[model samples]
Target: MTHRQVMEALSGLLLGLFVAVLSSTVVSNALPHILTDLHGGQSAYTWVITATLLTLTASTPIWGKLSDLASKKLLLQIALAIYIASSALAGLSQNTGELIACRALQGIGAGGVTALAQICLAAMVPPRERGRYSGYFGAVFALATIGGPLIGGVIVDTSWLGWRWCFYVGIPFALAAILVVQRTLKLPVVRRTVRIDYLGALAITGAVSLLMIWITLAGKNYAWLSWQTAAMVGGGLLLGALAVVIERRAAEPIIPPDLFRYRTVALAALASVLVGVGMYGATTFLSQYFQLARAKSPTMAGLMTLPMILGLALASTVAGRLITRYGKWKAYLVCGTLLLAIGFGLLGTARADTDYGLLSVYMAITGIGLGLTMQNLVLAVQNTVPRNELGAASSVVTFFRTMGGAMGVSALGALMTNKVGHYLAENLAAAHIPAGRAVAGGGIPDLHKLPAQVVPLVTDAFGHGVGMVFLCAAPFALLAFVTVLFIRETALKTDQQG
Candidate 1:
């Protein structure tokens, strides 16, 4: 493919990326209602989210390895097909279990969409052009991040179409993406026989699955120190150990070990994990906080999050362009991490009594910092790596980011549930109310349905939970700052390769 052809292909792929991200986030607002109507509880609602993350995390490396071995365009087409099929099935799901299963399948496809798009960008463009092109990727992510909730809210609030339409919303877009790919996304196929790493893949998936399940269930369905937790965590760790052995011995590993040999990559991976926790910990629950804690409608909640989204878009694009010119990303990464810490620290002061304007400022600060850091972190890694291993390097960082996100959501979720439960029990006892009768006791409650008297109790409890989580995640952001300090600055490369 010529330069012009590659850029055109990238444009088409980005639209597909927008669709994939939109599908994931657009239905988030309606999830609570979806689960409730399907006779599901908190765990089911979480699993609905968790299953997707788990599958995406596990399948990401597989897709990256495949991109190096076969046809990137063909793999992307297959991914879009899988997404469309899974989404349609999910829309028709009558039970939470069925829906969870379908979403998991959808996540596998989403992983392909994410992993291959990055690989394709690397295959077609040099690291320098990548910085500019990556701005487009960041914009797609921002657009989807913003649009998902707004559209979800509109669909959820529209009594005619209701929440189910949220599930169906992406079908047409997915089709369009597939058609676009077929028309515009052409590439030279990489020819070579490659092993699939089936055993390593299975073991890693199994290990991650076991750990995620344990994280989600422990301290809720069972005690944190229970036999189930012991069995799952222990077994998961053992499986992970086995996976490391397999990767070292395998001819072609799922994730190349040499990638970790570089200190920059190692630190970046760790930073990615921390960034994941700080980013997803609060951002994922922001809509819930607005709608449930503040009694805002879903549409209003979507509108309220616009500042954060806008800040993210502006910062990511501007920073990428600047980084391209200056070739100084490590400083931005450090500054971004500090901003993330400060943003969350300010957010830690949140309460039922705080105003929206103030909260938006804190959120925007976090968003801007995140915008500056998130895409650039990947750019830093991609810039530092050789052309041949770009897929593995990029996929590895992406994997940590996704994995950390899952961990953040699960761990913080557990914290929220526990804190809310304890606060409700204590306060109810003080007021001589029956703790069992308190409807919004454990975790964030459905604010729309809570009694007037209990609304304060629930919202305050949630605010405290959110604040506590920020307190926990702030240090992680700070850790990212420290890690960025150590990343050796390298000159940007402008030549296209391989």
Candidate 2:
């Protein structure tokens, strides 16, 4: 394909990617309102996020495996359709339970978009040229990341539109993506006898579900060291082991285990996990911090996040072009990971009264680090793996990162909830107010509904909880840096190989 043709095809793919990413983030600012409207608590707020991440993590490999055997273009179209439909359905959800179900369905589509977009890019662009194009992907991601919250905030604050538009807003973009791909994107649809490892897929899904259940519910519903915890944890591990055994024996595994044999792939996978845990885990609650602790309007909360988005966009665009020119990437990876640790460390100190200027600097640092690390990790692995394994390799890294995100969000969310509740109880007790009454009647921590005297305590509880969440995530970011240090540098390939 000519350069023009590749760019043309990428238009649809990038739009699809933007839509997928947009869905993931658009709910962040509006979440406070959504949960309030639905009469949900902290646990419900976490579940709303977990449901989507869990499905996205579990279904990613299936989409990647299917990409290798089926028509990439058809799969992309199907995925977009799924997203469009699910988004519309999500907007119509009457309660938190319905919304969570729709979000999980939406994630199945997102998994496809995430896996297939990279696979198509790998098919069209060789490693040497991919960095430049990967920059565009990064740009779309940053754009979506920035725009999602802002748009959702606007919709939520608007009387006529409300938060439902956060879900509905992505439909048009998804449809446009489908039409563009149908018209422009083309790839060889290799026909072969296909064998899907359904059993392995089931085991993997069950294992992930079990683990997330444990992570989200351990301290709340059951003791951390009790029989329930042991049962769930033990069951998840057993199923995961069974998945490995099944994958080894299957004719076509969802995740090809041998991909990990390459040192670069192994290191990249580890880095992806660490990056995901720190990045996704800590960032998920930023809006909550702003809304609950700082008492910012959703729109203001969205705007406050702009520094980080700007940093991400700038770093991704500049780093991509530089990597293309220099054929060197490890320095950026190392620098990015180090900065990520530092950023989290700084953000961990934030409290209800944190200066916006200082917080912006910390957020920008984390964003730059993410821009530098996220795509390049995949590039490093892609450079080492053969073209036939591109889909699987790309999906593997994405799968782990998402799985890490799922785990991080679940675990950290639980911690945040407990901390907030603890602080609230203590403060309420000191004030001679019944903590249970305040908590039981309160839904989703709206400061406006609380007595003026109690507002300060609630905000402090949230602020401290948010800070602790980031503090917990900082070590993971540091570990990512450590993992990247051990990765052996592999020169970028100049020639296309298939």
lDDT of each: 0.80, 0.90
Off by over 4 Å in 2: none
Q: Give the poorly placed runs of model 1, Cα more than 4 Å off.
A: 1-7, 440-444
Model 2: per-residue lDDT, tens digit, 271-369?
Answer: 888898887775589989999999998889989999888888889889999999999999999999999999999999999999999999999999999
Clashing pairs in model 1, backbone N/Cα/C closer than 3 A: none
* Residue-by-residue lDDT tens digits, candidate 1, 197-261: 98999989989888888888788789998899999999999999999999888887888788888
Judge candidate 1 against the unseen true structure and give its global Cα lDDT, from 0 to 1.
0.80
RMSD to the native, candidate 2?
1.2
Weakest lDDT window of 10 consecutive positions for candidate 1: 436-445
Tell me the TM-score of each prediction against the true structure: 0.96, 0.98
